[model samples]
Target: MSVRAQLFAASLSALSLLTATGALAQQGGLDPAKLGLNANENLRALAGSSNTAMVFDNRYEGIKGTPYAIPRWLPAKLALTSNIPVASVLLKYDVYKQRLLIRDPSRPDSLLLDANKVTGFALTDPSAPDVATGQPRVRQFRRFAEAPVATQKAEFVEVLYEGKYSLLRRYAKEMEKADYKGAYSTDQRFDELTDKSIYYLRSPEGAVAPVKLNLKALQAAAPSLAPALKAEGSKRPLKTAEDAASLLRAAEGQ
Candidate 1:
C-alpha cells in the first residue's frame, strides 16, 4: 500500500477506537469517573487528524504557569459550525494559543479541538459563585463572526452582559519569562502566564469598540444607564466586573 494510504488508514483506525467509547460519552458527556480509555491512546487519536487538529503542546516546555485562561476543565457546551451543538465536554480555553482544549478522563494530554468546527461555547464558571442563585455562574463566548468585534476573527469574546447594549471581554495573555539571574540571587525560577484582557461595549446595532473597565466608558457606551450607574457608583464601587454587570441588570430593572 502507498504511504499516504497507510497514513489515512492509521488515522481512521485510531479514530474508530475512540468512537468505540462514544457510548459512554453519550450517557451525558465524557464523565471523568467512567473513563476506561487510555490517556496516551486518547491523545494519539486526537492528534491523528491530518491538518485539522487544534495546535498541540505548550510552546515553552516546563513553563511555570499554564497557557489556559483557567487551568481546570469546566463543563462546556459547544456550538459547532455545522449547527450541531455538543454538550457535557470538559473544556479549557488556552488564552495563549487562543484555542479550546478538551479533557479525557484517562488522559493527561488535552484534546485540542478543531476551532474551525466550533462557532462558540458556554462554560460554567468553576471559581465564581452566583450571589443571586448561590450556584456557579455560567459565561458565554462566541467567535469572530458570531460575536463580531474589532479583533481577530478566530478570537472568542466573552459576553459579560448581553442586552440591547452588550458588554464583551477578550482575554490577552502574556508569558512572564523566568527571571533567574543566578543561583545565589533571589529571583523567580519559572515563567508565569499573566492576563491583560481587553474590554468592549457593543452598540444595539452591533458596533463594537474597545472600552475601559471604568464606569465612564461603560456609561458612555450605554447612555440610558448613565444616571443609574452614577447613583450606584456613589453608593459603592463601579470598579469591578460584578459592579458593571450589576448596574446593567439595574438598568434593565432586573
Candidate 2:
C-alpha cells in the first residue's frame, strides 16, 4: 500500500479514541480496525497524515445551502496518479472550492486531499439512476487538460453521456455571502451556495462545447444532430439531466 493509502486506512482505528477526547472524528462513523494494518504502522501513518488544521467555527452556520456536491459524505472510489487505488473512501467534494475533503478518524479536523494527485474519482448517488442504464447513478469525474470549454476555474466535470457525442456536467458553485446589512436590511441573512452548472457536448471529432439543457442548445452544439434532437426531444421534455442524456443518446444512435 502507498503512504497515502496506509494513512487513510489506519485513520479509522484512531477515530473512536480521538472522538472520545473531542479531538477529531471521522466524517461518518467508520470502522478503522477493519483495515487490518500493523498497529505500529497505523500509529505512524496517523501521525504522518495531514490534519486540515483549518477548521471553520460553526461550519455552515446558518447557511441556506451547502457548498458540497453532496451535503453528506459518501463512499468513493479514487484513482490516484501513481497507480494507488483506494476503495470505499469516505470523502466529500466541495464544489465551491474544488477541493477533495477526506475524513480521518484519528485527526481533530477533516483532511483535504490534494486534488492535483487525483486523476479521477467515482461517486454513487443512491437517489438518481443512470440516464442510459437502469442501474444506480455512478457519477464519474476526471480532469481534462484541454477541454471545449473554460476549465481553468473548475477542473472536474461529471461524465453524463459518453459516446460519439458526449455530454458533461461542469459543476459551478459560488458562496453568496450573507447580506444581512444591519437589522434593517431586507436581504437574506444566511450565506448560500448557489449552483450554476454548465453543460458541455463533445463531438465525434473530439471537440467539446457548452450546450444548454434544451433542444435549441443541443442543436446549436451540433448542427448535424439538429434533426435527431428535434425528433427525439419533442417526444420527451428536457426537464432534467436524464432527459438531456436520453436526447444525446438519440442523436448519437441516429
Candidate 3:
C-alpha cells in the first residue's frame, strides 16, 4: 500500500475507535459497582424515605391522634359534624337549664350536645343603642364591647361563627371541667358573649376605658371579687348599663 493510503486507513481506524469509545461512555460507563457503592448505600439514595418517616410519626404520635383530639376538637370543627347557625347569643344562665340542640341542617341525625352553656360572660340584648351605630337591633357583648363580634366573618356568616363558637364552647367546657382558667379568657378579648361590666370604650389609640360603672359601689359590695370584676371590666368597655348590670350580679352579696 502507498504510504498515503496506509496513513488514511490508520486514521479511519482511529476515528472508528473514538466513535465506539464515545458510544460506550454514553451507554453505562458510570457503573456503581466500579464506584464501590454497596446495596445499603444504594437503598439510601431513594427520595422521601426520611420525609415519609417524619410524616408517619407526626400523624400517629402528635396532637392529631390523642383521645382529646378527634371527638372533642375535631367533631365540633369539621363540616361533616354537627353544624348549626347561631340564632342568637345566650348567657350561661340563659343556657344553663335550657337544652340547646345544635342540629346539622344537612344531617338531621347529627346533633351537637351541650353547646349553649356559657360562663364568665354572656350576650344580651342591648338595653340602649350602640354608642357607635346607636342601634339596639345590632348585637354586641357587654364585656369587650369594642365590637360584639371579633372578626367580620363571625358577624356576617352566621354558620361559620356558630361552628367556631360551638368548638370554643366544647373546649371551654373541657377547660372548666379540667379547671383551666385561661380557657375562659381569650386573646380576642371580645366575643359574642361577654360580661357587660367588664367592657370599655375604645380610645382613639385603641386603649380600654371602663364604661359607666360605680366602681366604689362594686368595691363596697364585694371586696374580694372587686379585683376580678375590675380586671374583667377593663377588658372591653361595657358601653351600656345592661352590660354592667350583668357583671354587677357577680359582685352582689360579696
Candidate 3: 10-residue stretch with minimal lDDT: 158-167
Error of 3 at 138 (Å): 17
Q: Estimate each model's TM-score.
A: 0.66, 0.67, 0.20
**CA error at residue 119 for candidate 2, angstroms:** 1.1
Q: Candidate 2: lDDT of 97?
A: 82
CA lDDT, every model vs. true structure: 0.77, 0.76, 0.34
Which pairs in model 1 have colliding backbones?
none
Q: Provide the RMSD of all predictions against the true structure, rounded to 1 decimal.
A: 20.9, 21.3, 18.3
* Per-residue C-alpha lDDT of model 3 across residues 168-189, encoded as one tens digit per residue: 1111111112121265643332
By lDDT, highest first, what's the ranking? 1, 2, 3
lDDT, model 2, position 141: 85
Better of 1 and 3 by lDDT: 1
lDDT of 1 by residue, 126-192 (tens): 5898868978988888874534444576888788888777778888889887665656744666678
RMSD of 1: 20.9
